[model samples]
Target chain A: MITFMQISKRYGTIRAVDDVSLVVQPGELLALVGPNGAGKTTLLRLLLGLIAPSGGTASVAGYDVQHNGAAARRQLGYLPQRAVLYGNLSVAENLAFLAALHALPLQRVADVIALMQLDAVAQRPARTLSGGTAQRLGLAQALLADPPALVLDEPTVSLDPQSVASFKQLLRTLQGRGKTILLSSHILGDVQELADRVAILHAGRLIAIDSIPALAQRCSLPEQIHVVLAAVSGDEPELLARAGAEAHLDGDTLQVQVPLARKPAVIQALLHAGLPIRDLRSSSPSLEAIFMHLVGQAQH
Target chain B: MFRHTIIIARRELTEAVRSRWVLLCGGLFALLALALAFVGMRSVGLNGVAGFSRTAIALLNLVLYLVPLLALLLSISSMAAEREEGALEVLLAQPIARRTVVFGKWMGLAAALAIALCGGFGSAGLVIAVAGGDTSAGDYLLLVVRSFGLGLAFISLGLWLACSSSSRLRALTWGLLLWFSSVLLYDLLVVGATALFGGSALMTMLGLLLMANPVDLVRVAALIQLGGADSFGLTAQALIGFLRGLRGSALLVLALLAWIIVPLFGAVRAFGRRDFTA
Candidate 1:
């Protein structure tokens, strides 16, 4: 539902967003991940028409952002990074104002407030809310119009762990409801948990875009196998190494790093060695590891 | 578009109400107006400043100074604060047009200032009427309306400065400079210019120069309407004569209207073009 065609934004000599084209399909959750100054926010602003792209075009649904900003924006619900609301106004008042802008009925305000679990603090001023509650209020406003597409920029930046979990749950619910979501975040775990596909941006360019597992597969990074031994063995390391796996001894445990396809064979060889395997666990590469590896490779 | 504009305008008004800006400004105006009326009556001694024309004339100088200053500071700070507080970014991301945001803010702020001016002066007028003063209610109302126009002109100028400046401090600095230049320096410059160069051509130039500053236009308009033009010196008399009757008054009103529109147009244009990143 959202598309960027060769979109580029430059501020003087600095290119904030380079020539990048991306699409968030309907009912798809696309997470945009990048370090500081990777132009993620700039790209979002280009799509929102808050800034004119130095080159190319961005569109929401079918309307060009620059030429038809109002119509384009009508199809979008945006949650900005550090989502600042009117502090002096109550939560309900803030939502009511935004709802009025969209010409939504007053009842929609109550619905979103309840949906975001902000009904208890609806009458309180926004400034008094905690970071997590504030984030929920931000989500409430974005969900106010129930628009088909959502563009969330760091939607859970300041939230605590529990709040982040709840936020991920909300994203999952929205995904189930078939909403097109384009979110940019520094938290890769949240992105991995929620995004159907990940777009990795580095130095103003989109370097990679794929599902977490797909990206891991493409990177060919090793999965880790943790083997906790009942007792230490001098031959355990050699046995794991002979299986075409990198092995290290950590106290009474053997840690093996092998390709995903070779993991079964490596574990079978350890079992054949009769080392008395107390426990064996294999973990796929995390999004963080993949992201760091990708970003690290780009730096090189 | 109109609906969107009204939505924004309504929000701005609600902010004014919640902040009690309307109450504070209205109360300030009312207190100042009553004090000025009482002081004028004392100075007149036995003649009693009971007449609307005299009281309005007394209030004119105060309104000319206070309205533009208050309007400038209020508007400049409001826009600057919105940007600093990050509310402008949220507002811009809404589906409404940029022009609608500018126009809606102008409409809302102008209404708040109008309410303040009316409530303040209206209460003073009531005091005069109740105290057995012979003031004309219509004349007093006209003064209030003229003051409202003056407030709008300055508010637009302030918004233009707010839109164009990169930071709040810069906008505020420019706002104060504009206020000082127009309110205080403009008249002095006019007097100095006429004193240095005296000629019929200079008089014509001076007439045009007066129209260039909204404050001057408002001041001249109020003076002429209150029939106190003679007190402002021969140049004022000559300029008033050159403007000549209904045509001059209409031209002054038009000039004030242009002051409101031109800066507002500039603000909207600047707002529409600039990136909200800062």
Candidate 2:
């Protein structure tokens, strides 16, 4: 488990992380999302004990980050946004160095190397690696110790879609093994798919934190229902309106919007209206939209 | 702590070897040693190769000029580049103390420099011995060891500068200015100060100033040990009796050691206190 209790990091008058308090329970994946200067990296650094918090405390696996930093760090694995590893060392050498640092056996290096599918270019210098290969090496290093908790900041940024998929699969595997992960990213789709909880930070403060469904419900955001019809019916608009939905018709297809709770009633109404409905599709407000709505509110 | 430090140091040593830093510095030291020997021999009406004493004295000046600068640049560049390139942050995030990182770098770089100096001098010595350049190996080894000591002292200073500076460019700039001050500016300042003060005040100030720089400390030690004290300046010559004894030799050794330890301690403190954010 990882916990931050009222952590604050100040630089002169600017507060980078302002009185933030949160926890990632064991076997939970918490996604931290924010704008450019939203303190995501600062909070990660504070947790790693790379920088002391201006106030409060951070702990990893019950060890205080400040007082028991080495022990705390031993329980944690970190993958920075752009993990510029040792450029002169080969891929295997870089992994081996980190492995030696954590006192792990040499077999662990080969394991992570194979886990990340980095066997082909293990002997190549890190500086010559492609973006995807280098980031994989970074992940390999992070996984070398097989720590109980992992903190990955923008790990998938700048990666190709295939690599991102590969990375997420590996993360899923680790998650399955009960690793507590705090992932920071701008990619809300991944967070929506993977996170047990999403923490939205803005202007150095967490404006919102909850599961996507809970957040959407709390915000009372609308969901879209795309209705495909076999033939245009003049009464379709009136029927949707009568069913208390805000809808528009283009040809035989009707696009409808309603409160998430009202979705079932709209579908029932459409079926009962005797219209030749070819298909019906519903999309809830995306995490991105929820983020924007919340951040916009916080901004105001 | 020892394991972590050793691991880091070993990696640093590997980097040095792979980057050809060891070879580069080694080759430079060897070429310069031979070149100085040849130059010293021709400076007189003599040719072939100079004697051990003559070559040792010439090499002492070379050590002061080259070793410190190389050590400073090598160490500062390594530390600052790690910071800029995000290696330090990743390494620090591991379960290691900040001092371990600093000390590891120091030890590893120290070993690399020692190997370079040894290889350089050993190869040059082999060449010299085969050609009947000089018969005495003791003086040659002493010069090599002193040059390594000088390099260590400057390496510590460079690590301190790297830790204290906010950026790589700033660190490099500071390292260069420090090298300039240590090598050229300090001596000129002392001379100007001596001329301005003149008399008893100048004598004490000059004596203190001689001990203040590692370069000058090694220089005075070289002058005394190589029997050039009487032939050198009166200021240094005045200390002939005091510095020539066993106690003075021990004091000078301790002083050189202080040059290594003090700055290294500063580096550890600075690194621990500062943020390793990229």
Candidate 3:
């Protein structure tokens, strides 16, 4: 449960977040996908009350970010873009200090340690930890309070594949527990697999907000048809082009773009022309495709 | 607010005790204290100053120089390092008020300075006891009380220095300079100017210049404790006697209070408007 009413934050002459109003329902995983400097982190910080917005208002769980910041922040768990932890403190000690700050019970420290899989190195000082381990520690501290909402800013960037996968699994677990998660990331696959709903941002503005499937359709990219052929002669390319279409011929495989309404006619024409069609399938754009298309359109 | 402050204060004190640098520095101050006591006791026995004026003045100068130096080195970096490490944001994002964090940090640092100077003076007092020196219990108690006030003043000044500067290195530099100028250099300039301008001008300027350093008030407290009030002529002795009374303790208390309050007020004002993320 988060709301932004015409929230905009400016630094000097540039607006980092501009006139963006959106709501996140409780118990939803919302992915904020944007290019670099897209105001994703700014919007999150505004909600967390880490920075005061220059105009309008932001509220977390119905508490005004400016007026009731302390109370509002008590219900927020935030992992910032740069999680600077005390290098000399043990993983357990770091979590304990944060848990104490949140007034969490002392036992919750061990619970977070177990949840973050930090039990093995719980006594090890954080300076000796690997980057992924440190990232997990930061996440553990954020979640130690068991807050109602989580704002994780770029939690997956620079993490190894296994770490990324583990992190995704953790997010899914949190989502299952009915915690509202707003994850800002550049990794499309993670967002595609983990996000229940996605909000796309471009240069300090919200460009699109929808489910992944709906987002693909809104991108207006033609549907792609993957057709595997037994052979592609030189004249077959010209024939496909004369049919008001473009085709790429790759060693007995033809990937073509066709209108949804014209798919049947194109397939029939290919079949009648004596081309051996092994497979034909229509596919919507990938998340990457949709992201680039939407971001590109917003820039112009 | 008080609960949050206590929480932060406990955290700070725990962290400070764990730092090897603090432990080593505290050890060094203890060594310095012992050395000063040994040297002052021997010199006082030979010089035959039954009034103990010279011995008292020497001890006062040594405490003034060391207490503030150690306090500055220790406390000036408390918040700057937290800010640099981004831990300040994490701490602030909790339910704690900004002023609570500031006051808590100041108290934690004050506790650290207290333990440090008390350890140093406590060792000095022990050396005197073991050596069977010509000192009263009141002498040791007075020294401890005076040093406590001095340490509090210096630590508060350190907090102020840290608040005014954005960088740790700069805070350290400014804090050390403030201590050096006020403790050693300021009096040296007064002595030199008095020599150049002769007695009347020196007399005219000394009172205002002396007030420039809160450590001077501490020195007065120490001088009165050691029975050295009469050695510095009627004006200096009268000033010492005046500062030694209930009124004097009140002034000393006010100075220490300002040391803690003024800079803390500035820090809170600056911090509330500061862009902590930057």
Q: lDDT rank, highest first?
A: 2, 1, 3
Which tens-of-lDDT digit does each residue in A1-300 have in candidate 3?
888899998989998989998888999989999988899988887886667899989988999988998888887887865564666678888887787777788799999899889999999988788878888988987899899898888988868999988988888899999999888998998999999889999889899999887887666666677778766676777777666556787777777776555667777777778877788887876788889888888878
lDDT of 1 by residue, A36-136 (tens): 99988998889888889999999988999999998898888888876757888999999999998888899999888888889899999998999899888
lDDT value for model 2? 0.88
Q: Tell me the tens digit of each residue's lDDT in model 2 across B155-257.
A: 9999999999998789889988988998999989887876787666767787678778999888888878787778756654555566788987888898999
Best by lDDT: 2
What's the iRMSD of model 2?
1.0
Consecutive 10-residue window with the lowest summed lDDT within model 3 chain A: A80-89
lDDT of 3 by residue, B189-242 (tens): 877766666455655566555556778767765666666666786555555666
User: Which consecutive 10 residues in model 3 chain B have the weakest lDDT in total?
Assistant: B47-56
Off by over 4 Å in 3: A234-236, A242-244, A258-275, A280-283, B41-57, B133-137, B188-212, B228-238
TM-score for each model: 0.96, 0.97, 0.88
Compared with the true structure, all predictions reach lDDT values of: 0.87, 0.88, 0.76
At residue B135, give the lDDT of candidate 1: 48
DockQ of each: 0.73, 0.80, 0.52
